[model samples]
Target: MKLRFWGVRGSFAMCGREVLRYGGNTTSIELVAASGTRLLIDLGTGATELAKLLMQGEFGRGQGELPILLSHTHLDHIQGLPFFTPFFVKGNRIRIVGADPPGLSLQATLQNQLAPHYSPLNGLENLAAGVSIDTIVPGSTFTLGEFEVETALVPHGNMWTTAFRVTADGKVVTFLSDVEYPEPEAPLPEALHLARHADLLIHDAMHSDDDYQLRRGWGHSPARAAISVAEKAAVRRLALFHHSPDATDAMIDETVWRARAETKIELFAAAEGSYLEV
Candidate 1:
């Protein structure tokens, strides 16, 4: 499988010369299987740039079909939905998959995001594309083309966020964003399961140790916490992801540098537009 990071920032989007290197778009990623099946994880602001690129292919002609796996409905994660160009193309098909929140179904939650008060698009019905929403149950496994996907629910402050493990062509990639590790030195069983011996693990590194002290219940993990998970899971490679919005490029560089010192696993910060084959 081929993986690309379109956005990696956390909480909100940020821009300026200070953020150019690591990028400022919030949590969107694209994964493509060997059979050319495309899967998108999250619809953060970075999706708009991805939309521009997809417009050059089948999506531009409204003949594309793909599944978007959302971690949750947080604004930074879904803010790019309305601006995603394929949604305005009549023949395109989009299946949005995510865990159902407390009271709202997955579909209703998304519809609420696009409601008149929040968006000019009014609702999902206003989109030209044939959009379908699937509410995935935690701990269930599903297949999307050649990719076998496994979902697990992990604690995220006051809510539960879905973590995905996707396997294809004998390779595994695990994505665990927006999760807060209760114990910095101990890995959650669900998170360990999703990342165990995986080829690549993209885990949240949204805060520094000091930042985490003040934002303990904000549904984000510090860089050291992510490293601890990677070590416990024994993942082949670790990509520090979901960067804090307040983090400058230099700060992220320091985070990566510090994380590298504690683990023998290959590590790097996930940067926008960076691609990896697993």
Candidate 2:
């Protein structure tokens, strides 16, 4: 399996020379299985660039089929869907999969984003692609193409974010973005289960210890929290992801440096446009 980070920043997009190395776009990831099955995680601002690249391939010919797995409908996570290029192409099949938010269906949540007052496209119906939305139950296990996926609900403030564990070609990768560990010293049971013994753990590391104290109730984890989870889960490697919008590249480097001192596991910050083969 192969994984790529298209965007790493969280909360919102940021840009400037200070953020050039780590990147400035919000979260979006691309994962491809050995059998050539491709999956997209989130549709953040990075998707705008990913869209441009897709438009040069089968998606450009309107003969592409892609499955998008969403952790939640937070603005930063779904904001780039309207700009996803393939949505303007007929015959491109797009399946959006996610757990619905409180009192809302997955489809309804997305349609709300494309509502007349908010989007120029007016509504999801106005998109030219053949789009379908699937709402999955939290803690469900399912198969998509060549991948076996397991999901668990992790706390993200009052809302719950879906943490995904995907296994393909005998390798495992767990995505635990936007999750906040209630107990700073230990990993949540659900989050630990999803990340247990995975080849790679891509986790939310959106704050530093000092920053986290000021935003305790915010739906994000500090690098130490992520390191604690990685240690408890015994994952092979941990990729600190979902960087804070206000964190400059230098800040993130410092965060990684501090994190390395806390854990013996292979660790690195997720950088936009970087890929890993597992």
Worst ten in a row by lDDT for model 2: 179-188
Alpha carbon lDDT at 273, candidate 1: 71
Model 1 TM-score on a 0 to 1 scale: 0.98
What does the lDDT read for residue 207 in candidate 1?
A: 89
Model 2 residue-pair collision total: 0
The superposed Cα distance between candidate 1 and the true structure at residue 73, in angstroms, equals: 0.4
The residue-by-residue lDDT of candidate 1 on 13-46, one tens digit each, is: 9999999998999889999888888999999999
Candidate 2's residue-wise lDDT over 13-99, tens digit each?
998999999999989999998877789899999989889988999999998889889999899999999999998999999999899
Q: Which ten residues in a row have the lowest lDDT in candidate 1?
A: 181-190
What RMSD, rounded to one decimal, does every model reach?
Answer: 0.9, 0.9
Off by over 4 Å in 1: none
Measured against the true structure, the TM-scores of the candidates, in listed sequence, are: 0.98, 0.98
CA error at residue 7 for candidate 2, angstroms:
0.9
Each candidate's clash count: 0, 0
